[model samples]
Every structure is written in structure tokens, then in C-alpha cells.
Target: MKTERAKEILVQLLRIPSPSGREDRIALYIMDFLHRLDYDVHIESDGEIIDLVVNPEAELFYEVHMDTIEPRAEPFVRGNIVYGTGASDIKGGIAAILLMLEQLRKENKDLNVGIVFVSDEEKGGRGSALFMERYRPKMAIVLEPTDLEVHIAHAGNIEAYFEVDGKEAHGACPESGINAIEQTFEMLQKLKELEPFKVKGKYFDPHIGIQELICENPFYLIPGLCKGRLEARLLPEQEVEDVLDLIDPILDEYTIRHEYTEIWDGYELSEDEEIVQIAKKAMEATGLNEFGGMRSWTDAINFMYNGTKTIVFGPGNLDISHTKNERIDVRDVVKASEFLMYVNEIYGKS
Candidate 1:
């Protein structure tokens, strides 16, 4: 695929607004693009997952998300970087994948490969989860912004809501009422006193933090209810239930209600795994390096949990994702596409 063609696809993808659940238009665009290549393609999960089957029996596949956190503005290029929402987060990777597919078509190369473009990755990875319910590939390459590195492992995460119940009373009669906000603080304090959860292969230990909070009450009345969203990053050896059990004592101290919104266990691939070795070789061949572990969760967890040896790789930096200034170097996109081509060639032979 030509560099200009990759940039053109990137621009088109960036212009579309696909935030989490709303990925129809972009999914349609991808379906159309793959369809034009005369590949057997279909939409699943109510158009949230686009499955392009170049070879149905292929054990090796690639996955990339079409969804972004939110659309910030129309994409534009400045010098070597393309700046806009989703540009660095994933559109650049998506573009690279499409360009690689085009190259395969142009050269009439028949290889065992499948492409999965899923929505809802940013929200809860529902699209990938839905795909994994039926199809299981032996290996997969999850395209996320990793600055052109071979990402072997990453921490998993769980999203949950913590609710505290307290008695409400007039502010003037302070002793008659219990404040839920105060109860929340007390719970956090107790939680902070425990040792942080750790695992050997993970990049970091288990971490728990509050993402959002809400307490409603009139000025004259004390709050009776408080709710906050909590996120916990987990390692492969760390179970969500185990972490909850650790915190259960503190929660039991108060009248707390906990609801888990999303949960994904972490995963790690051995350095000697055949897929990892192939990716490392591909990176070296493409003039890139095998970087360190990814510190955050991604859709890769979904694939790994489903019995696929999955690795995270792509262009740009994860830090630049989900920001107004999200961007990727055009050169990085081209390099990733070339690297992926090598991986396909080498892995296909094995």
C-alpha cells in the first residue's frame, strides 16, 4: 500500500464520529472498504463488529477498534503528524491495516488472515467479547498505540460502583444524621492502609482509585446516599474477587453496596512464545524495538482470555490517545503497516 493511500484512509476515518457505542458509520465505512477488495466480509453484533475473512481457516488474525473515546474535531495533518481524536488512539492503526490488506490484494497474495474491527472497545470491549463468544483464533495482533513496540503484557482492569447509605437529617440537627460522604472517606482510608496487591510478571501492582462521585442533598439536609465509580487495575495473578475480598472488610464496616460494572483479568505472554518471537523479529526487521510492558488495559485481554495468544502493537503513544491533541506520525503508520506485513509473511509460513 502506498503511503498516500494510508493517509487518505486515516483522514476519512478521523472525519467520522464513532464514540464507543456509536460506530455504525465507521463500521459501514470499513465494511465497504473491505468489500471493495472482494473479501468475504460481514457485520455482527448489530453492526458493532466487522469481520473480514480473507481465509476462514486462518489461525492468525488481527483486531483493531473503530471506536474512540469521543470525536473532538475534524482531522488535519501538520508536518508528519495527523492530529485529531482517534488519530493516535487507533484510526492510524486501522488505516495501516486497511493499507496492508490493499497491498495483499494488489499482489494477489493468498494468506491465512482475518481482520476484526470492533466497536465498544473504549466503553467495555463488548464488541470483542461478542466476537470471542464464537470464533477463537490461535493468535491475534491487537492494534493499539504503542509507539511501534511489541507489547507482550499489560494489566487488566475492573470498573465498579461503590454506594454508601446513611441516615438523612436536617443540618441543624447534625447528630441525628449520618453523612454518606464521610462514610466514603472512611472506607477509602481503611482501604489505603492495606498492602498494595502485586504480581511478578505484570508491569504494575493492583491499584484501586475513585473515578467519579455523586452525593445529592439540599443545603439544609445531610446527604443520605453517596455513590462513586471505582476502577481497579489487576495483574494476571490477581482476581477481581480476591481484591474485593481484601476490601470487603472495610466495606462491611459500613452499609456499602458494591456493583461491578466491567471486569477483565490481566494477561501475559512468555517471551519465548512463538508468536512473541515472530513479532520481535518483525519489529527488528521493520527497524523497531521490543518495548516494555503496557501499563493499562486494552481489548487484548478479551482475546487472550478466549485462548488466543494476543499481543498489543501499533503506531503512536498511548498517552496521546483520548485527548483533544491526539495525533500520530505518518511515518509511524507506514512503518507499522510494513512491520505487520512481515509478521503475516513469517507467521503464515510457520
Candidate 2:
């Protein structure tokens, strides 16, 4: 595949607004591109459901996600870099896959490889689960931005939402009701002291975050509820449910007069197996072992949980994934695309 052409497509994908469940246009573009290449392609009607590409009776497969974390922040470029919302998060990775397929198509030989670019990875793995239930491949190469290194592992994440409830009463008579807002604040204070819930972490570069409380309509009446969201980075040995267990008792107290909900489970990939071996070989062949950790949650854990030897490897600093100034070096894009071509050639059959 031509590096220049690949960059163009990468920019185009980055320009599309594919946050979570809204990946219609981008998915359509992928299906169209694959179809034009004379490959069998199916764009699932639900948009964020699933996509399938078959090698006209061939084998092998490559898997990726077409959705992103946000809409494009508008496109811009400076020397050696392209700046946009999806540029690094995985657009560069997707570009690499597209280019790899193009290169294989030129060889005058049947690659017998398939491709699937799913949706909803930013929120969950419904798209991937759809494919996993209906099909299985010789190997699955999940494309996430990992610079040029072969990321043999990725931890999971638990996006948790905790709420506090109270009785609403006239503010004029303050003692008439309990205050859920104040209770939520009290719980937040306790959460800070919960022993840190430590674990033997992996693929953990120690990433963390917190945001302001959700907005609610204000009135003279006491507020009936208060809620906040917290994200925990899942480690190989730690289950996403562990976080829920840690907070369950604290949550149960509120349950007597409130509500409790668990957003989702965190996922993890612990072994260096089939996908890992193939990735390592390709990296070794390319002399690109200088790889680093995923440092956050990704759909890698979903694939791993489904019993597939999945790895997260591609090109881009995940640190820069969703920032307003998000960008990826053009050189990195080309290098990752070239590196993936080698990975596909090496693992496409085995």
C-alpha cells in the first residue's frame, strides 16, 4: 500500500465523528473500501453491531474497531504530523490495516485473509461479541495504537457510577429531609480512604482521572439525588468486579434508601500466547521490540475474555488519544502500516 494514500485515508477517518455507538458513516466508508477492492464485505445494519469481510472463500482474519471516543476536533497538520480527534487513538491503526490489505492484494496471490472493523469499543464490546459468536478466525490482530511496539498485554477497566439518595423537603424547614447531595459528598470522602485497593498491576503505567459531579436542576426544594462516575484501571490479576466488591457495602447502606448500579466489568489479557508469539516474531523481524504498556482499558480484554489470544499493538501515543491536540506523526503512521504488513504476512496463515 502506498504510504501517501494510506495517510489520506487516515485523515479522512479521523475527520469522521464516530464516538461510541454512532459509527455509521465511517463503517460505511470501510465497507465501501473493502468492496471496491473486490473483497466480500458486510456492513451490519445496526451500525455499531458488527462487520464481516471474507476472502472470496479464503482464510485468516484481522479485527479492528471503526468507532472512536469523540467527534473530530477538526483536522490540522504540521510537519510530519496530522492532528485530529481520532488520529492516534486508532485511526492510524485502521489506516495501517487498510494499507496492509492493499499491499497483499497487489501480490498476485490469494491472501485468504478476512477483515472485521467493529464498533462500540469505546463504550463496550457488543460489536466484537457479535462477531465472536458468529465466527472464529485462525488468529485475531486487534489494532489499537501502541506506537510501533508489539503490545502483548492490556488490562481492563470498570466505569462505575455511584449514587446517593435523600428525601426532598421544603428548604424553608431544613430539618424536614435528608440530604443525598451531602451524603454523596460524605461517600466521596470515604472512597478516598478505601485502602487504594492495590494489586500486582500489569500494562499499568498508572493512569487516573476524576471529574466534577453531574449537573442537576436546582430548586428551593432539597435535591433528591446525587451521582458521580469513577474509572479504575484493571490489572491482570484484578477483576473489574473487585472494584464493585470493594464498594458494595458502602453502596448497600445507600441502597436501603437509594439505588445501586455497576457500569461494566474490567477485562484483562494475561498470557503471551498465539497472538503474542506472532506479534513478537513480527516485531523481532522488524527490530521493533521497543514497545510499551497499554496503560489503560481497551477492548483487548474483551477478546482475551472470549478465549482469543489477543494483543494490542499499533502506532500512536495512547496518552495523546483523546486530547484536543490529538495527533500522530506521519512517519509513525507509515512505519506502523509497514510493520503490520509484516505481521499479517507472518501470521496470516499460521
Candidate 3:
């Protein structure tokens, strides 16, 4: 593949802003690059998914997220580091794959492989799922920056909405209107008291963290409704339905009309599987000295849940995915591209 130019493509992707639910522009840009290479390309309107099939005969499908959290004030770099929102999270990995696709074409090396650039991976996995159902690959690799290691397992996330209600009245009659904010505080406390939300596995966090809560009309006009978004990162073995059931009582006790929606779930690749062995062999061939599972959640879990063996391996440091100072190492880009070539070849031969 064209790994030598990995840095250039990766840098270009980092400059784009493709937040969740707003990935059309970036997806089209990648589509252009893939099309120039003469590869089969298509965009799934469901999530604006941009998919590539460089070698139609290829069996393995490589996937990466094409959306960034946001853009920085100004592009800046210093000493092998570039700071921006999407650098490490995934744009870095996307660039590497794009360059590799081009390189494969330039070198006349057809590994019969395909690539998928998915949208909204930062939020719900609906984008990836849309592509997966339509184009189910035999084996899959999620492009999540993991410091060059072969990480297999990932936690899943379930996002639910809670709508709290209250009596609305004139601002003058403060006592007449029941303050919904007060009820929110009470509900939150009980939700926390449910306590000890356990997740199986060694490094998984047992308790789910509250992501954010949106409260409206807290002042001036009477406040009638308040909504809070709760996020729970579940374990691989944890049943999402069970967690939703656990929250049932808490919902009932509260004097409000609540709405719960299951956002998504997580998954893992059994250590003894064929996919795991293939990834280990590829990493060894690429001179990568490390391998493991990532603590953070990734689309890898989604594939595993679908009964497809999956692995998470890509360029950049995942720690920087959502940070203001996010950046990826240039060397990782080239290395990951080269490795992707080898992995694709292995999968194609198998």
C-alpha cells in the first residue's frame, strides 16, 4: 500500500470537522480519494456511510470512524505532535487506511479487501450497524487508535433519556409551581443509590458514569419539564435489557413521566478464536511488540455482538480522541498502513 504517504492523508483528515450526525462532508471527501484510486465506492444514506471495495475478491473488511468531535481554533503542530479534536480518536486511523488503499492500487497489489468509513461512531453505533447488516464481512477490524496494540475487547454504552415533570405556574407564584429541579435532584440521588452497577471482566468499570443532563426553563417562565440523559457503559457479558429493568423501580418511584431508550451494547472476541490468532500473527509480522484489549468502548463490540469475530487495532493514542490537545504520532500512521496491508493479504489468502 502507499504507507509512505500515510502522514499526509492523516493530517488532511484531522483538519476536517465531522461530528456525530454531521459526517456528510468528510465522508464525501474520503469517497473522492477512494474513487480516484478506481475502487468501487458507495455512500449509505442511512448514516451517510462511505464504503470502499478496493479488491472485490477480498474477504476481510476494515472499518474506521470518519467523524471528529470538533475542530481546533487553529491548526498547530510541534515536535511530532498535532493538536486537534479528531486526531487520535479515529481520523488518524482513517488517513492510514486511505493511503494504504491508494498504495495498493499504485503498486498493482490487489489483496481483494474492502474498507468502510462509518459515521456517528462517537455517539450511537447506528452508522456501523447500518453498514454491517447491508455488507456483512466474514471478519472485521475496527479502526480505533490503540497505541499499535491488538486490542480485542471493548465496553458498550446504553444511553437513556429521563423526562421529569412538574406543575407550571406564574413566576410570581413560586410556591404554586412544583420545582422540577428539586425532583431531578431527588431522582438522581436514588439512581446513584441503586448502587454497585457491576460489569464483568478485569479492567471494566463496575459503575456507569452519568454523562450529562439537559435541564430547560429553570427560571423566568415557569419550568414545566426537565430532561436528563444518562449513559451506562456496560460489560461484555452484561445484558442491556437487565440494566434497563433494574432502573424500572427508580423510574416508578419518581413522580414524572420518564422515557427510556436503549442506545447500544458492547462485545468481545474470545481469546482462543481464529480471528485472534490471525491478528496476533499479523502483529508479529509487522514487528509490533504489543497486544491487548482497550479499556474504552469501540465499534469492535458491536461486531462481536453480531456474532462476527472482531479486533481493535489502529494508529494514534486513544487517550487523545476527545481532548482539545488530541494528536496522533506520524510514525504510527505509516506503521499502521503497512500492517493493514499485511493483515488484508493474510485474510484474503485464508
The candidate maximizing lDDT is 1
Q: On residues 1-350, what C-alpha lDDT tens digit does candidate 2 reach at each position? A: 36567668887887778888788789778878777777777655454375655552323456777888766478777766888888888888888877767777777544545667888878767888777666655456677777776666565555556666788888776589877777776665665556434434545632223344552538887766766665555554455556667766766776333333324444444445666666677777777876445656666555656666666777788878888888888777777766777766775466
Ten residues in a row with the worst lDDT in model 3?
50-59
Whichever of 1 and 2 has more TM-score, that candidate is 1
Query: What TM-score number comes out for model 2?
Result: 0.81
State TM-scores per candidate.
Answer: 0.87, 0.81, 0.80
Ranking by lDDT: 1, 3, 2
Residue lDDT tens for model 3, 192-298? 66543642465456455456666577567567777777667666666777777777787676646656565455666677877777787778888996766676667
Measured on C-alpha atoms, candidate 2 has an lDDT of 0.67
> In model 1, which regions exceed 4 Å deviation?
1-3, 45-52, 106-108, 166-179, 197-202, 217-222
Could you give the C-alpha RMSD of every candidate to the true structure, in order shown? 2.9, 3.9, 4.0
Give the alpha carbon lDDT tens digit for every residue of 126-205 in model 1: 88887788689888889999888888877767777878998899988879999888888887777766665433443556
Q: Where is model 2 more than 4 Å wrong at Cα?
A: 1-3, 44-50, 56-60, 70-72, 109-112, 165-186, 205-212, 215-225, 254-272, 290-296
Residue pairs that clash (backbone atoms under 3 angstroms), model 3: 2-103, 58-112
Clash count per candidate: 0, 2, 2
